[model samples]
Target: MNGIPNELTIERRMAVPRDAVWRAWTEHATEWFCPLPWKAPEVEMDLRPGGISRVRMVGPEGEEMNLTGVILEVVPGERVVSTDAIAPGWVPQTAFMISVTEFIADGDGTLYRASARHWTDEARQQHEAMGFHEGWGKVAEQLEAVARRIA
Candidate 1:
C-alpha cells in the first residue's frame, strides 16, 4: 500500500510464527489488545468484510473506551483492515481512522506491521499526541508475549 500523508505506521519483529501471531490476534485479542492497567474485557469480531469489530477497553479505575468498526478486509494470517468510519450493515459513524495490521513470515518468526490512516492530518497529530506509539508499542509487546505463550 502506498504511504498516505496522514498515516501512522509501526512495526515489530517477533519470535513467533505468523500463524501463532495471527491466532493470538484473533483468538486471544482481549488478553493483549490494550496496554497494561487498561484491559479489554469485551471484544467481538465477525472476521469478514463488512462485519463488525468491537472492543471495550476498561481502565484500572473503571473508565471505559468503546470502539466499534467494520472490517474492510481480512487475509487470514496475513492482513486485516478495518475502519471506524462505518459500522456493520454499512451504517455511518463519526469518522476517525482506518487500521491495518499485517503479519508476515520472517525466518522462523513473524514481522508485524500496524498502521492507522486518519481522516485528516490533525487527527493523525492528535493520535500521536495521545501516545499512539507508546501505547500501541506496549500492546505489540504484550501481543508477542501472549503469542509466545500460546505458540
Candidate 2:
C-alpha cells in the first residue's frame, strides 16, 4: 500500500440486502443513490465488465463533475470493481490520482471499500490532508441510506 500513494480506503457496513445495495450502486437514474448536497440527476451504467459507467454529480455554484469509468468486474449481487478518474473516459486525467471501488457482502449487509491510488507519496499525503475521509464517508452514508430504503 506504500507504493500506491494518493490512495484512499473506506470501509462501511450497512444494514441492507446485497441485491438492494448492488442496485443502489449499479442502477442509473436513481437520484436517491447520489443523495443530498451532491445531486446526481442522471447516471448511465452498463454494469458489465469492460462497460463504461457515466455519472454526473452536480454541486454548489452550478459545479458539476462528470465521471466516467470502466467496469473491471461485476459479480451480480456481490462485488464490483471500477477505476475512476477525471478523464472523459477510462484514461486517467492525472496519473497521481485514481480510484478503485470494491463492494463486498458482510453477513446480512454489504461492505463497501474504495481505494485511491496515487503516483507519489506527496500526492497521497496531500489528498489525505484534504479530507477524503469525510468526503467519501458522506457518499457511503448516502449509499447505505438509499439501499436501506429501497430494500
Candidate 3:
C-alpha cells in the first residue's frame, strides 16, 4: 500500500483552473463520476479528514455499487485521500483501495492525478484487467467537461 507496485493511476491535463476541477471533483461528482450507460445518481463528499466520502453507482440493469469511505486527508484545492477501511468515528470495515487525487496548477489549466493504491497485488491486477485506463480516462474527460461548464 506504500508503493507503485500495487497501484493504478489516471493522470490528465484539463484545460481549466485547479479550483474548477476541485469543484467538479467535490461538488459535481455525481454528474461525471461514472461512465455513460451507468450513472452515479447518489454522491456525497464531506471532504475533510475523517469525513465521509461516498458514492452509489447504478447500472443500466439496476445493479448497484455503493462505496462509502472515510477521507484520510485533504488539502483544499489540492489533494484528497480516502479509503474504505474505516467508517465514521474510527469504526473498522473491510479495506479495499485507497484513492489519492490531486490537482496541480499548470500554465493555463490543471494537472489532475488520480491513483488507487490497493492492499494486494491481485487487486491492482484485477483493476487493470477491468479497464482502469479506459474507464478512468472517460471519467476524467467527463469531469473536465463539468468543470468547464461551471468555471
Candidate 3: worst-modelled 10 consecutive residues by lDDT: 1-10
Number of the top lDDT candidate: 1
Given candidate 3, what's the lDDT at residue 15? 93
TM-score of each candidate? 0.97, 0.77, 0.95
Q: Where in model 1 is the C-alpha error above 4 Å?
A: none
Better of 2 and 3 by lDDT: 3
- Stretches of candidate 3 above 4 Å error? 1-3
lDDT over C-alpha atoms for residue 17 of model 1: 94
For model 3, how does the per-residue alpha-carbon lDDT over 1-151 read when each residue is reduced to its tens digit?
2457798998999999999999988888889998887899999888789999889999999999999989999999999999999887888999889999889999889999999998898988898998888999999999999999999
For model 2, how does the per-residue alpha-carbon lDDT over 25-73 read when each residue is reduced to its tens digit? 7762445534467788777767677677677888766788777766667
Instruction: Evaluate model 3: give its lDDT.
Output: 0.91
For TM-score, the strongest prediction is 1
- State how far residue 151 of model 1 sits from its true place (Å): 0.8
